[model samples]
Target: MGGLRNLSGLDASQLVIDGDLKISGNNNLESIADLNGVVITGTCMIANNPLCVGCTCGSIGLAAFTTSTTTTSTTSTTTVTTTTSTSTTSTTTRNPAYEGDVLCQSSAQLADAAALLEDRLRINGMVAFSNYDSFTCDVDATTLASMTAISHVEALEIRGSTALETLAGLEALAAVEFDVAIRGNAALSNLSGLDTLSSIGLDLTIRGNALLTSLSGLSSLTHVGGQLAIQSNPVLETLDFMTSLGSVDFLLISNNPLLTEVDALASLTSVNTLYVFGNDELANVNALRNVTIVGDCFISGLKDCVSPDACSCSDL
Candidate 1:
């Protein structure tokens, strides 16, 4: 079934398809959870159904398909064949999951690092790179650009890279299963490379980047499962790129001296703890007036803005 504009459900669970299975371009399609037990003998194609959630063939327990690009978006495609079988046996071919940690500390290891990430699409452990005072080796954006095959990692830490100016290489990263910390990268300017990242399973901390000026790369972020902290980025000026962010657990916006407004938090409707303080230039926080917070809040250092009492759940 392809291009069926109103097709919203496919209950083919435990069914066997002898021919190629194609489900694509259904504009109103939403759920494919029922297709989890499907067995396809021929190739499978499921793509471009804008409203479909968790629609990937691999996500539904079918064999992983060969695709040039992989993203968390609904517009994903999969195509691969399976052998004919008489029994009701099933197997899932998931992307390779690396069990060991990956660390790329220098330029000499960049090629090896890229090759390792290219083969392991999912890393079950941490991926870290620390270039605090390494004058002998350089790990810049160009070094990270080679590792595009990595789609998911348990944790990611990039710290103190003087040569790293932008996150232009991590474009293929879609999700972080744990925390993500980017700190003390003095030359780093913006988050322009994390454009496709949609969710974070835990905390996200951006701290002490000397020249960083914007959060422009996180435009696709929709859900942050834990704390969202942006602190001590002296020149960081706005939260504007976080327009797509809808919910987070603890929201901490502290010490970003140049940050003047949080108007982009208008899309934020769900949060637990809210701590906005030490931002000397912060004046406009009218956006927090409509946010729904279920826990405590501590807000200060603003000249003329709504009080935390105004955002109390009791008022709602």
Candidate 2:
């Protein structure tokens, strides 16, 4: 027992107990066969082992000697040590997912999703860096705040965001480009104060917001470089603000089931492609005299025009 500490025959991976062992060392193992943290493969055969005398069949083959582990005294008190260095100097911190970043995806990962350009994006540049140049936020019906606190986005596409309740704060956008597609927000009801937008460089698509009843928000977009489609917003009884739009190359307003009058569309002068169909209550095509677009004008429900306009749909 005296020369056993200096024997240097201990294996860290596998320990074999051949003798009837008595554990004594507080931090060392006099006999590791008595420990519980270690695993025993063969029939521990507690019935045959010497330590388990009165234990029942429940503790039949195994035993726990967690209390008996004691430390052994060595000639030198240098304990075991790990070799790997514990340095954390070069590790980098990562950014968490949040609002106001270009290209946000739910399941399908996006490409070129550059991290927040600068942390303090609101104060640095005139152009909204929190701006979305080319991206789609096809969120689930549960993520309704898809329109919250949207301070600066260059181009935003909202598709299949079904639980969107309101189109609020979009009136505050001063300069948004590319496309602002609010499609499939089925629960959207109101677009109250969106007349402040003065300049747009691309298309503006507002489709399938079922409960929207007014065209009051889009009264200020004076320049659109591409198409403008507002379709399937049912119960929208009036297009009273279409006269304020400055220019549109292609204008489409279709599938509104209950639209009655489009008095404001008579003032549109810059449209190059005009289409109004699927609206059951519409009974006049006289207001389409000013359109100069290049596509089919499917004015299928049009009637009762005192002066038939120069459109190729009816005037041809």
lDDT (C-alpha, whole model) for all candidates: 0.75, 0.50
- For residues 1-316, could you state the per-residue lDDT of candidate 1 as single tens digits? 4544443365665476665667666777776766776665445566767677657666666544443333342233347654442321122232355566888777677677666665345787888777656632346776677657678888988888888888987888899988899988989999988998999999999999999998889999999999999999999888889998999999999999899888888889999989889888887577777788889888777755454533333433
- The TM-score of predicted model 1 comes to 0.65
- Supply the global lDDT for candidate 2: 0.50
Q: How much does candidate 2 score in TM-score?
A: 0.52
